[model samples]
Target: MTTRSRTAGPILLAATILVGLMAGTFFIFACAVMPALSRSEDRVFVQVMRDINDVIQNPLFLLAFMGALLLSAAAAWQSRAEPHRWWTWSGCAAYALVFLVTVVVNVPLNDQLASATGSATAARADFEDAWVAWNAVRAGLSVAGLGLLAAALTVRGRR
Candidate 1:
């Protein structure tokens, strides 16, 4: 392999893994956490979700969250000369959408949910459905990105 392709291989691998981690996180929330929360009492749902949002800001999550974007971008750039570069480029594009949705839609909704007052039921009503819907969307997008990255890694050197 060429020097750039060799370099791209490891960076792309790390990017794929981080993206997969994030994809699994969103998928778990969509398929399990939100579904379980949907059946809970409003107080329980609101409190648990608030706690989750608070706790999810720690280092490890941030690493995966930010690393997925940064590394995927790096991987795409590094692989730009490879014949199979389109997969990495497309994967980065997909993750870019995931990042955009998280920032634009999900984070703002989380902020809105955080500031909600008066009743737990009201907070849950405002937060749960929208959060669940967007989580599902991000999950699908992240998974697709992961698939594209993995394809880039495994199908290297091909046209």
Candidate 2:
């Protein structure tokens, strides 16, 4: 490998790891925390959902999402010249799907929930179910991306 490839390879690897961590956090929040919250009484559940809505709307989540997208894109670009180009491309595609799903489905639903009131609990519940469903899809894509990253790392190490 050339000096540039050597330098870029490590950077891309780091980016992939970082994005994986962010995606993992999101998956855990949805799968673990949200489910536990749903077990509570109606009022508590609504409040928990509202709190989750607030957390998701925060700038921190936005920053993590955007940062991960950019980093993953960079990693994908760098990987094109690597021997395991397919793994890199697959990871890129998975990450892109995750972002698209979040933007298309989750963001709108989150916005609606943000505007909802106690009187609109029924509507919120409908949206929340949809959100959970979409989140499952997101989590699956994230796992795929993480797998791709791992595969790419392994391939790179052997080269």
Candidate 3:
């Protein structure tokens, strides 16, 4: 194999792993975290979510969240000349969808939820259900992106 192809294989693999990591994180939030949060009293839930939002902004999570975008972009670029380019390209698009939704929908909601004052119940009413709904979309998009990246890896292997 040529040097470029050899390099593309590993880059794409790393991108797939990062995308999977993001997908798993969102899936857990949907399936486990949100359900538990839903059971909490409104004040406790709001406080817990605020704390979580603060903690989740740490460097490691940032790496995975942002790395998925950067790495997928790299993978798409590297695989551009390959026969299986569509898979990587589509993976990139899916990741973009995830990012855009998070930035446009989720982050603003989180910000609003975090800084909310007066009535926790009112905040919960305004934020929690809608946030959960947006998160489900993120979960699905990230998973789809991961699956496409996995498909790209498989196609690369076959080449």
Clashing residue pairs in candidate 1 are none
Q: Which tens-of-lDDT digit does each residue in 1-159 have in candidate 3? A: 788767887888888999999999999999999999999999999999999999999999999999999989999998888877999999999998999999999999999998888799999999998899999999999999999999998888886
- Which lDDT tens digits does candidate 1 get at residues 17-53? 9999999999999999899888889999888898899
Worst 10 residues of 1 by lDDT: 1-10
lDDT digits (tens) for residues 51-72 of candidate 2: 7777666677677677667777
Task: Compare the candidates by lDDT and give the number of the best one.
Answer: 3
Indicate the residue-level lDDT of 120 in model 1: 92
User: lDDT score, residue 77, model 2?
Assistant: 80
Off by over 4 Å in 2: 1-3, 57-60, 118-120
- Candidate 3's C-alpha lDDT? 0.92
After the best TM-score superposition of candidate 3, give how far the Cα of residue 19 lies from its true spot, in angstroms: 0.4
Q: TM-score of each candidate?
A: 0.94, 0.86, 0.96
